[model samples]
Target: MGKKEKSYALGVDVGGSHITVGVVDLVSRTIDQKRLERHPVDSKGSLTEILEAWAGAIEPFCQHEVLSTVQIGIAMPGPFDYDAGISFIDSTQDKYESLYRKNVKDLLAKKLGVSNAQVRFKNDAACFLQGEVFAGIAKGYKRAIGMTLGTGAGTAYYHGTEAHDAARWGEEYGDSIAEEYFSTRWFAKKYQEATGKELSGVRELVDMKEESWVQAIFKEFGQNLGKFLVKFASEENAEIIVLGGSIAHSSALFLPETEQVLSRSLPGVPIKKSILGEESALIGAASCWYEA
Candidate 1:
């Protein structure tokens, strides 16, 4: 087999409450995935354990294949010392031991026995953006921005040939404004207030399919994102912007408002929903493995 086909790439996305891993034959655009493997990351579990668990979770999917070399791409939460691959989880909201967590990239490689494996990492949200631009709705757009609305708001900018990357001003000032506005938490809270029910979670509200409540919450989300995009696009002069993540699925409720606001404030900035679905991260992260 050719060297290109022999080297398989692995992508690892570690999120606020879960770890997802994927193996891809980028040469043929073939992929395998393991999703949402929840860990006690916020509990007593060590970062070492979390890393190993993620590696092990992906091993079985590739065992039956003929992969000769491995490269790993890790997507992490930001404000991490990315150059050094050291990160601290938002233990305030999650369950990591912020004071004791170690270098996740090193640990993942060691536990997988790919200690010398080529690896690259960026903010998890950036991976989603890269995934979108590489093969999703935003493909071929040379200048664009990506925003993911989920547990929290996330934003990434792609300019020139450099695709997805962690924000230099992220995970700190990020949470103070737009990130706090478009989050699913707000939807849940609004739903709770609208229904006079102390929600167990957003899932409950989503199940109700209450149009009024949903529209109100998503309108706020769109307004927040639109305001943020106005600032971001004017600064970067991007051509297009896309949204992804779980909340993006509800674009019907948010898109019109978002577009309306963007049209009024930014005039010509084009914005749309991501087409990568959930696989964008896996593909983008795996593609980074090849680039590395």
Candidate 2:
């Protein structure tokens, strides 16, 4: 008998500043790392520029003969109509404002020389968690909350079978919404407020770890995160929590405090960092075509 042919799908992860595309092996639920492509994008660009950037990253994969017939699954940021392939993102958000009310599926399909049916979309946050749940750290857990703390805050809920966007970024929290408190902007804002100096992001802040103020800042962040998770996890009955994205790389600085706070209430709930990193979203996005 001949060896079975491996099934593949195209996965795309669209971020505020970049887009990543890869070929995913469905049976193994992993990305073909060698074939990965990434490109920087100006989210503030005109509608045509943004679409071209996304389509450009994805076009090469589709051109490969073996992948020509494969479906394309995209992990896109919200406010988007995932089912209809329309974008509702607006100027209020710093990214992808030009896509407001645009039919992205049709646009990308035309650009790629494919039909709209060949493309599918899922919330980026949900795709991150779904990738984790499908093959990463949360694989065995029945209920999990996946968080990506970076330039913005992303939340997703996995209900064992599938994951969905938690969409809690705008939910009320301390002085503002959860996004204000949990994102990179918050870290920069807090640091500037305390020292009257500018901070690029968490990476720069991490370098100043020896400073008492930096230590205090991380501890406070942990406390706030833990408190917020307590309520979210309790409501979702989350069995495990997986953290990813840029801020999560510095988790060691804040995880201890977060654990301390969780121990008081949601003790025994495992909190883990993503093992797959950026590939989580890629695999998750491609998995959308796994059953097809």
Candidate 3:
């Protein structure tokens, strides 16, 4: 008998500032690290320009002789119709405004010289959590939740083979969405208030760990994260929660305080930081095809 042919999928993660493309092994739930590629995107570019850039980034994978049969799966940021693959991004944001209401799947497929039916899309948050559950930190959990904390907070809940956004529950902190408090801007604002100086981001604040104000900021951030976790856990009945994204690098600073908050109401739940780092979404995107 002949050896079984290896099946692969092209996983693309489209973010506000960057796009990453890679080939993943559908059966193994792992990405081919050597084939991973990244390209910066002008979020403010015109419709044609943005699509061209994305297509250019993905073209190599499609044309690779070894990967010629690979399917495409995109983890795209929303407000989008994943089923129809149309973008709903508004002009209020500088990123992807030109793509508003565009049929992204068809556009990209045409550029790749493939049929639109070969491509699939999913919410970036959903992809993030699904990746973790499939092969990252939340692998064995039956009910899991995940968060990606960066410019904004991204959340998703997972069960069995799929993941979804945490349904909103009228809970608001400081009169705004939960993300407003759990994101980088919150750290920046709090830092400026305490030290009377401007800092670029959470990384800078973390670097100044010697400063009393910096420690205080992370402590408060942890407590806030705990509160948000409690809300999600209560609603979703989550068994484990995993944290990812750039800010998670500072886990040492805030995780203790976060645990302090969760212990108050739900000590039994496990909270873990993502081990796959940036690759979670890439793997998750590929899983969309294999898991389906």
Top TM-score: which candidate number?
Answer: 2
Compared with the true structure, model 2 gives a TM-score of 0.95
Best by lDDT: 2
Tens-digit lDDT string for candidate 2 (50-86): 9999988988888785434658999999999999999
Clashing pairs in 3: none
Candidate 2: RMSD to truth? 2.2
CA deviation > 4 Å runs, candidate 1: 1-7, 28-44, 61-68, 98-101, 164-176, 209-214
lDDT of each: 0.67, 0.90, 0.84
By TM-score: ranked, best first:
2, 3, 1
lDDT of 3 by residue, 27-57 (tens): 7778898999999999999988899899999
TM values, all candidates: 0.82, 0.95, 0.94
Q: Positional deviation of 44 in candidate 2, in angstroms?
A: 1.1
State the local distance difference test value for candidate 3. 0.84
Query: What is the clash count for each candidate, in the order shown?
Result: 2, 0, 0
